[model samples]
Target: MIQDLRGANACDADGCDRALTEPQLVFETDAGRREAYECPCGAVTITVARPESSR
Candidate 1:
């Protein structure tokens, strides 16, 4: 099964299991894109994706 991982969220630093704010576009290219999600509790999560053509 193909799961959509982009919907995943970073847990808060307090361990409350709260979702972080929307991710910001940190980088991008013809090959892929990068995003950053920051929690008020100072937790940060970065995600990267590459197009199938880039493989």
Candidate 2:
């Protein structure tokens, strides 16, 4: 789980920061798998694929 110490985007008035929570989901595709995190500001950040050995 992700932690939000400053109430999700404490720096901005709209509270659209992506670092406030964990990624929405972990997906596996033909190309690879990644964790997707989205913010209220329409910013989507995808982490690199996890190692197959770990999965």
Candidate 3:
């Protein structure tokens, strides 16, 4: 598994696991970056935190 240190909530509201695939670019903003993942059950949203120094 990818050891992404960034905090993540890898499941949907129903508490289901996703068959994650290569992330596809969705968009980005000044707060952080966003990527979309394909899933057999549902979708996953991962948010990576900006570096403290960059804040």
Candidate 4:
């Protein structure tokens, strides 16, 4: 299942001018949780948040 975790202000991609304040698509995996942020320039930035227990 995919979810939005919220807390996004803008696109993190370089040379992109997209103003977005919505949460990214989140996916849970064995490695960790992944957040996919979309940019207006057809770019997608993915960030992973691992559990503290695993670290």
Candidate 5:
């Protein structure tokens, strides 16, 4: 099952909820992982929460 655990790390604070454009590995944590995205206006970061069942 596909689940979206995206947070409010909204990109393009200007006026666009830019999706993860240039998704690059940013970091990882026991909770989940993070990826950085580049928007024409700026950059944003998002993290996915790991499901308890998977761990």
Candidate 6:
């Protein structure tokens, strides 16, 4: 089963914008994870792999 993670830090492609507030659960997939931010203008982002050292 896939574990659901919430409020992970995310940023836009430009790297100029970062999620100011916690992200809401949107969905998850094998390719990556998706989350929605509080900002209405915000776009969904995919989460990459977790750091090996962190595990």
lDDT of all predictions, in order shown? 0.62, 0.54, 0.53, 0.63, 0.53, 0.47
User: RMSD, model 6, all Cα superposed?
Assistant: 7.0
Candidate ordering by TM-score (highest first): 1, 4, 2, 5, 3, 6
Q: Which scores better on lDDT, 1 or 5?
A: 1
Which candidate's lDDT is highest? 4
Candidate 5 versus the native: TM-score?
Answer: 0.41
How well is each residue in 1-55 modelled by candidate 1, as lDDT tens digits? Answer: 0123334544646665666556754687896877777666767777777877877
Q: Which stretches of candidate 5 lie over 4 Å from their true place?
A: 1-12, 17-19, 51-55
Candidates' TM-scores?
Answer: 0.62, 0.44, 0.39, 0.56, 0.41, 0.32
Q: CA RMSD for every model? A: 3.6, 6.1, 4.8, 4.8, 4.9, 7.0
Candidate 1: regions farther than 4 A off? 1-14
lDDT of 1: 0.62
RMSD of 2: 6.1
Residue-level lDDT for 16 in candidate 3: 72
Candidate 3 regions exceeding 4 Å error are 1-19
Model 5 accuracy (lDDT, Cα): 0.53
Q: In candidate 5, what are the lDDT values of residues 1-55, reduced to their tens digit?
A: 1123233334647677754444555566776665655566765545465656677
Residue pairs with clashing backbones, model 6:
none
How many pairs of residues collide in each model? 0, 0, 0, 0, 0, 0
**Predicted structure 3, TM vs. truth:** 0.39
The sequence of per-residue lDDT tens digits that candidate 2 reaches over residues 4-50 is 32235332326553343666777877666666666667766555654
RMSD of candidate 1 to the truth, in angstroms, is: 3.6
